[model samples]
Target: MVFVALLGTGTAVAGQVRGPAVVPLPPQPALPQLPWLPPLPPVPSISVQALPPFDVEPLDLDLESIGDSAQEAVLQSLQALGTLRESASVSVLGSLQDGFAFRFSQQQPPRDRTEARAEALYRSARESIDRGRYENAIQELDRLIDLPGTSRVDAALYWKSYTQAKLGQRAEALTTLADLEKRFANSRWLKDAKALEVEIRQASGQAVSPDSQNDEELKLLALRGLIQSDPDRAVPMIERLLDGNSSVKVQENALFVLSQSQSARALEIIAKTARGAVNPDVQLRAIRYLGAIGGPENRQVLDEVYRGSNDAALKRAILRAFMTGGDRARLLALAKSETSPELRAQAIQQLGVLHATTELADLYRNESSAEMKKRVLQAMLVGGDADRLIELAKSEKDVELRRAAIQNLGLMAAGRTGEALKQLYSSDASADIRREVINALFVQQNAGVLVDAARAEKDPAMKKEIVAKLSLLRSKEASDYLLELLK
Candidate 1:
């Protein structure tokens, strides 16, 4: 007798379908199965062979097999990933046979290789010049000039000419200068090129007369050269130009040339011109030159002009000259004794420029006018005398003057002024003074201190003012303090 059984779906195991487990039924009493089972004609000796386990792996679709639509979808997904990650790694290849030809690479901008190379060569040339390697620099510059469309061509030509001149190749340098002039008519480098041409001509013993040049700038260059080569001759010509109806620029250049001379004649001419021997403008220039020359004699010359002159503008020029000459004693004398308020104020300002804090403090003590004292305070501030300013803020009896000192203190460096302001704020009970202190701290952006003051402050009005200031600030401390207030 045979028994038949039905099978249900099987389990998958390691890429192979497995048959379900079979169970044997308990042996039935013999009769019923034999009659019907003759049909189960001998489930004859059946033989089964288990097949080899099938191998499995992830599918790799060929690029050729991927459709255009599918490719676009994949590329878009990669682009989205790149955007989310803020990266440039995403790329799409056209085909496997094309061997990693990226479509995205075509969108990338090409680098300015020519510009980069030109810049490198130009820099190398400059470095070589600094090291006194003229020949090497010339080689690099030549290479740079050969590059097409280089913006530095004009600069290269100028430096090359300069290098050629340094090497005593005067004829070659002139040729290069001529080429630069022809190629770039409106180039800014032409000015320096002309100056260099004058220098080279002078070095070669060629004459360069100031009168020959039409351009004032070129004439100035020529005059400078003449001064160096023949000062006696140059001095007479300069004197003629100054005394003649030459342009003011020409006269100034002449004065500058004369100032460079150490001869007694030059000094006499400068002194004579300084004492109003010329127009007011030239007189002012002369005064400045004397001050710039700055010696016992020069100072004497300035003093002579100051004592002899009544023009307020002339006196002010003298005062500035004193500052330029670093003659603090002269400035102090004027600040103390000058009766003209405008002149006195000018003197005080000059002293401040000299940072003569001691002299300023003394002037403040002797000053009877509140206005003059206020000027003294301003001068002290300009001199960066924070210690004096702090003293004035603390002890000054005049409210306006005290407030002025506090405001100036705010303009100073915070490290020194911040603590001083905090101390003043705590000690002073006057709301106006405290408000000035708060404004000073605000200018310093000392939000941490403002927050502390707000918490400790009893007046609702002042607290609200501090909070309002904090609202305009973007600092983390201000924001955090505001958040705490919200809580």
Candidate 2:
């Protein structure tokens, strides 16, 4: 079967061809298109202009201070594996609140006393909170929170919420809209607050939806509005929808929208949803959610699911989750252990797409099953291991796997992958697999081999099909073979 590579940019995305590339069935599945998410209230946009403007002065961070153990960990974590990992990390880093305050005082009357004084004050306020110092903590937090949209906003909200909740003003805090809501109702966060209020109630075993919003439409509309207004707030609502009486649509929308909310809170809820989802749709959506909000935690959840799941589709979905999470190790491990040879092969193919070589290379080299190892080689090509893929096709045992590997060797039009296809042209094996090799060899642009195969072929039908294919990818070789056949 001819292997179809769904090349994105230039990466292979699928598997081993049997003979003729197995054409996919027609009829694309349709689902309901999602409604537009409600607009989120604007987040507190801190002006970078407030900070000292950049100069030629290089920004020096004391990377050494983080300790030696972190160095190796950081490197592995920051692997340049050409996955969307770098982009995902960039997205995550872009979202962190600027919690740090570079307290610059030109009038540093005493350098020694400044840190100590601030430390003392910070400590005193923190300790006061422990000792029923709500007012003191509030006072200190006020100054900290006021420093032009500081990272302490979450803390500020917490303190404000806590003080109000503690002082028997729980209803008010519950009903309270953030200042962002009052000042900028059009912003993303306002919608989040409305959604969050319902979620908070649900988490507390209080009624989650408004008394009037008993209908699914009303609840869904409210949720859609939430992610638009306040992703932070909407996240809780989405989680609650997952857990509550909401339909799968509401839950899916919440999950989908929260994935974009891109806050720690959103990530936290998505993790919980992935772990706790009973509905497969909910669980699968959870995978996409984790991918959208990728991290070690998200990776761990997918890995756990893959390890625990027996369903092939779910396993495939979980494999997809790992790709999104950028957990190569977990993905390869799952691939190796998958009971379904198809899933295992798919995992290997995906690694090829990722251009990850070593993860499956050695494991595949030692694979005992001919059919299985072939699957690995197919996977490797998809993953972008052109050089190794070429080598494996040359050295591989298990004739079936070797032939399968040969077919994909030229995945990236790696002209080199086809060299093996040259040798395979003469092999006396299944005509189907051999016919497949004809197409795979096209990567190396070997028209002559295909021409010879077509003319010298013993199977009339297989020869006809190969001739048709060889002509389709390019006409010269097949036409040459056709001319030779006519003689």
- What C-alpha RMSD separates each model from the true structure? 33.9, 27.5
How many steric clashes between backbone atoms does each model show?
A: 0, 33
**TM-score: which candidate is best?**
1
- lDDT per residue (tens digit) for residues 33-125 in model 2: 999998732322111111111010111222234443342232222122212222334223212101122221221224322332333344344
Q: Give the Cα lDDT of each candidate.
A: 0.67, 0.52
Q: Which 10-residue span in candidate 2 carries the lowest summed lDDT? A: 49-58
lDDT of 2: 0.52
lDDT of 1 by residue, 308-350 (tens): 9876657867887887788889889988889887578668866
Please list the residue runs of candidate 2 whose C-alpha ends up more than 4 Å from where it truly belongs after superposition.
1-233, 308-312, 337-343, 410-416, 423-474, 477-487
Winning candidate number (lDDT): 1
User: Per-residue error at 455 for model 1, in Å?
Assistant: 2.1
Clashing pairs in 1: none
Estimate TM-scores for all models.
0.55, 0.47
